[model samples]
Target chain A: MIKALEDDLSQTFNIHFKNHDLLDEAFTQASYVNEHPHQGLKFYERIEFLGDAVLQIVVSEYLFKRYPEMPQGKLTRLRAAMVCEASFSDFAKECRFDRYIRLGKGEEKSGARQRPSLLCDIFESFIGALYLDQGRDAVERFVRIVIFPKLDEGRFDHIIDHKSELQELLQKNGDVEIDYELISEEGPENDLTFTVSVIADNQKLATGTGHSKKVAEQNAANMALQKMRGK
Target chain B: MIKALEDDLSQTFNIHFKNHDLLDEAFTQASYVNEHPHQGLKFYERIEFLGDAVLQIVVSEYLFKRYPEMPQGKLTRLRAAMVCEASFSDFAKECRFDRYIRLGKGEEKSGARQRPSLLCDIFESFIGALYLDQGRDAVERFVRIVIFPKLDEGRFDHIIDHKSELQELLQKNGDVEIDYELISEEGPENDLTFTVSVIADNQKLATGTGHSKKVAEQNAANMALQKMRGK
Candidate 1:
């Protein structure tokens, strides 16, 4: 089972593990270790710990360079949104990690492989194993290929509610007044499109149109955030 | 004031900052920014954020390589002990970071410079600045010169209570009975030393002596931990 999964991972990811044991250990659940006492199989907890640190640094470095002008708070928030458990689970699903997980009979019956937290842990453990077997370059390459495309797809954009993010960003500058005003309404009431404008310090920052007033306000806030971020 | 501190830091640390502003920002408090609004000075929060991730990765990498046999949980605990507020404050004081810190009149009057939290923030921010001005290698070098030596000095050893650490370690490997037995007492009652032996699974692992029974037990646990850690 371990060899088959290792082969699948290599074929699917286009990366070969020098130490197959590391790869196997990355997928091995704690429950599996509990059942196989004499097998001396190690769980993925340690690798997960290391991989978490690696992921943090890699993402931080990427954000630090990509957004040179972004404040540290915003950069930190962005990194958090990108690497949070939900995001990791999504990445794991995309990589078909569920298919390769090694669990005990109990955990298998309980459907532990489909768990988001477990999947996230496995994802991080895999990165840890890859780092150990290959190197930083290989780990970075893996992240870039498997994860960076999500950035382009704006998968994490929804994680940060633009309205709240904009508000927080504005608050950091001082007690600045921020107002989203309804500018116009188009079409009939049932299918109306609302235009909203975001004003920071009485200056019109940006405007957007949406199907509803709330969405229009959010879109306006998103536009304002982009403007403030100098994007 | 900033220039003088910058010179002192450069001289003491043997590090030349190409972008001196980054270094200055690392020590600039938010209160200082409030006082010098027209000066457009940046605070250390953002740099501290980046520096924090850098520090974690550097320390994690160091430990991962240094103790190949150490379990991940222990490694995590060791990293936490090393990077905790107390440790960072100690590092900051050793570098005389208080002298370089830019504080508002209010904070200065209140003796905020000597505060541990502020010192830790500055220490992390300094790393951030160093990473930005130079690179990972330079940041790692700084940590190695200033922080790694402390590990050799046994400065962080006391941070983890040996008894609890040992219990946690033993619990990870399944259920095991740990017993601490008082072996002997020496000297008069008022100034007596107690010797204790730690037994795991009825096997005496190590013995320790201390002035009090609790201390003796702790010392015995520490000895047991060392033996188990293969030190």
Candidate 2:
């Protein structure tokens, strides 16, 4: 499993870790360490701590250089939106990190591998391990390849909490009626999906789908905002 | 004034900026920009923003690597203590940054350069300017020379809120009577200085002096705690 995951990571990232143990530790959870005490594997917490700092600096530098005219307050908000849990989880899902996470029997039984927070931590841990094995340039390259493209493509727009933003934008021209309507619902009750459409001034602006109504509404609002901004 | 300040900074940091404008911007407050509208000098806010992130990653990486066995929580607390406003202000004062800050006449009259918040911002701004003028290696070296030695000497001991820390330490060995007494007061009412003594179980442990009673008490507690730890 480790070898297969390593190959996948290498193929995906176009980079390989010299110290395979760092890569191994990136996927190993604390619960897994408890069950495999003799294996001498470290958990992901420390690596996640380091990775969190690395991510902050890399993203902050990128934003600072990219937006020369942007105010500090906006840069801070943009950085927060970019590196929040949802964005990290999305990146993890795109990389198929859930397939590589090592969990104890109990944790595996509880489906902890599919958890968003766990995925986020593993993503950060992977960055940390990559940083230690390679260097800042490699880690920055990885971020550039995996994360910056997504930023350019507007993949993480939903993290911006755009409903309030859209309302605020519309409110500039006096009071305007903004609404999100459930357009469709599907799948089982436990895993139901929702599609919502955002309307402003009786015009259907945009539509989006998500696992929950609120998320769908937010996505729809975000799409509407992006279109409004002509992005 | 700018040329003299630049020479002073060059001597202080032992590194010269290729672009002297970055150094000028670092010390240029918003009020200064307001007064010198035709000078095309930018304020320190944006630079401070970048420097803040740079400082965080540098300090965090140092702590993470230095204390391999330290927990993430403790690392976070230590980083906060190291980079807090008070610590940055102290660093600024040590470099005599207040002597070089450019402020409008109103701010100068109000002693804005001596303000802790302003000092902290200027310190971070100086780092940002340094990072831009040089590179990461130069910025890291600057931090090593100027800041890391202080960590070794425990200059930021007061950042831990030593009064509470001392109380917690004493409380661990059952209840202990910890008292702070005003040992002496000097200067006039408007510019008075206070001397405080920390007494534990009727034994005077340490004494400290500050401009305010609260600061004097905290300094006294910090000194006592340091004595207890033999640091």
- Number of clashes recorded per candidate: 0, 0
Q: What is the lDDT for B22 in model 1?
A: 93
**Runs with alpha carbons beyond 4 Å of true place in candidate 2:** A155-231, B156-231
Model 2: docking quality category: medium
Residues A1-231 of candidate 1: C-alpha lDDT, one tens digit per residue: 877777777787778888989988999998999999898898998888889988998888887765555677678778998888998988898888888888999999998999999999999999999988988899888888888767544465564456776777788758888889999999987999999999988999899888988778877887776676676
DockQ of 1: 0.55
| Docking outcome class, model 1 | medium
lDDT of 2: 0.84
Q: Encode model 2's per-residue lDDT on A139-214: one tens digit a residue.
A: 8998898788775455645444568768877885589999899989999989999999999889999998889998
In model 2, pairs of residues that clash are none
**Which 10 consecutive residues of model 2 chain B have the lowest summed lDDT?**
B151-160
What would the per-residue lDDT of candidate 2 be over residues B89-120, giving only the tens digit for each residue?
Answer: 98899888889999999999998989999999
| Best-performing candidate as measured by DockQ | 1
